[model samples]
Target: MSEPLYHVSANPHVRDNGSTQKIMLDVIIALLPATIFGIYIFGAPAAKTIVITIVTCVAAEYIYQKLMKQPVTISDMSAALTGLLLALNLPPEVPFWLPIIGGVFAIIVVKQLFGGLGQNFMNPALGARCFLLISFAARMSAFTYDGVTTATPLASLKAGESVDVLRMFEGFIPGTIGETSAILLIIGGIYLVARKVISPIIPCVYIATVAVFVTLFGGHGVDIQYIAAHLFGGGLMLGAIFMATDYVTSPITNKGKVIYGIVLGILTGLFRLFGPMAEGVSYSIIIANILVPLIEKVTMPTPFGIVKGGKSNE
Candidate 1:
């Protein structure tokens, strides 16, 4: 018999032109608008945090890989993305060293220690944000805008004070660097969806779930301002659109994604309404990320020619 012309060796024989570097670059590009706006609004402090955090993340990853004798992958831009996200989540007035600590923790502890990028169980940025929040509660909760220390829009809402919903939507309110601008975040999210870098399922469903949850249990009956505040305030938009939709941490199947979104929405609502803190998006998404495995297992589709109970066609 003649030799075969070709050989198939693995299940993942299908391939595409997409690369990790390309996807990361696309995300970074999409984030640029919000990043620039954040810097513009927050001034040199924001710029400093962003620059330092990104550098620290890339440096941490490179140094770790070099020390471990692994192939250095800083060019992939995942570390940079992680740093940017962590910095964006930080308070603009945070000490310069905060992002440095966060970047190192995100890359080394949450990401590389778990076997690097795709193997990270939870979103590294969120995980590190949670860590920083726990370690620096007062610092993380402090907010300043326009050279004055003040409560965030969500905090005002929690304190039974009404806020300018329009201003909040317009990102004029005090909050984290990147999360204040609903319009810009949504624009970035739309760009990501148009580029097909992410599915709209998680972000759309997650936001919708939060809207519905807050409307029902928020003690405000069909109030547009209240619902919009919940939607636009805090880190909900940023986390839902960016971190929750992360490819490695989010569920793969459509069914799993829906369930994950619902879980995130409910948890966020619970935390915001009843917990000690007014913000909950980070914790909610991190919790849901931990549940991705079980969600995928339950929502896994059956193979072709396989019956429900695993009986095959005769």
Candidate 2:
């Protein structure tokens, strides 16, 4: 027989030059404005938290990979990204050891133990945040701005106290290190969309859904300040723009993505309005992450030549 010239791979026959490192670098770049602003606003403590968390995450990944005889992938920057995300979620006033503990749990337990990177069932940073939030509620909930302890705008709103919407929008209010600035976070989200790193559907839908939910059921009857407080006064923008859109944890198809956004929006609205906590972004995103598989399964497109019930049309 004549020698064959064609070659076939198992699947994913087409590929692109884009890499995990490049994508992570782009995300890191997108996050810089908020990160720098946070450091400038919170001073050395924020910087310290960021540095320790990132280093701990990177080191944990490196050591674990080495010990397991796996190829070291610390250079990929996923661990660094996870650490940065976790630190941003934390109050800058947290003890130095907190981020270290968070980083270790994020990398070793939520990430590596689950098979690392794409294999993780949830965002590692968020998993760690929830873990820390439950374990150290007081520390995690404390907020400070300009060295003075204060209630976050969301907390004030939850307590029926008037909040300075302008300050919250401008990120001058006390909150987590990175989540205070709505404008800066929006800018970063815009950059991500421009780079095609993420789609705008989830964010837009998620935000819109929250706005409508709060407006209809908030008992404020279209009060702009109340809506604005719910929107810009918490971690909603940060979570919607960055964490909830995580590629591995989010839905892959457009339909699935839209459904995912709705679920996130409703869950967040429920938690913030009815749950004991004033903030719900982290919990909402993590919960939605766990539902991504079901979303994708239902929204998966039928094959070109296949029918709805798996019968061939050809």
Task: Estimate the Cα RMSD of every predicted model relative to the unseen true structure.
Answer: 2.6, 2.5
Off by over 4 Å in 1: 1-15, 308-313
C-alpha RMSD between model 2 and the true structure = 2.5
Which residues of candidate 2, in runs, are more than 4 Å off? 1-16
Summed backbone clashes in each candidate are 0, 0
The global Cα lDDT (0 to 1) of model 2 is: 0.91
Q: lDDT (0-100) at residue 167 of candidate 1?
A: 86
Listed in order, each prediction's TM-score against the native is 0.95, 0.95
Q: Whole-model Cα lDDT per candidate?
A: 0.90, 0.91
TM-score of 1: 0.95
Model 2 clash pairs are none
Q: What would the per-residue lDDT of candidate 1 be over residues 233-256, giving only the tens digit for each residue?
A: 999999999999998898888999
Which candidate leads in lDDT?
2
TM-score of decoy 2: 0.95
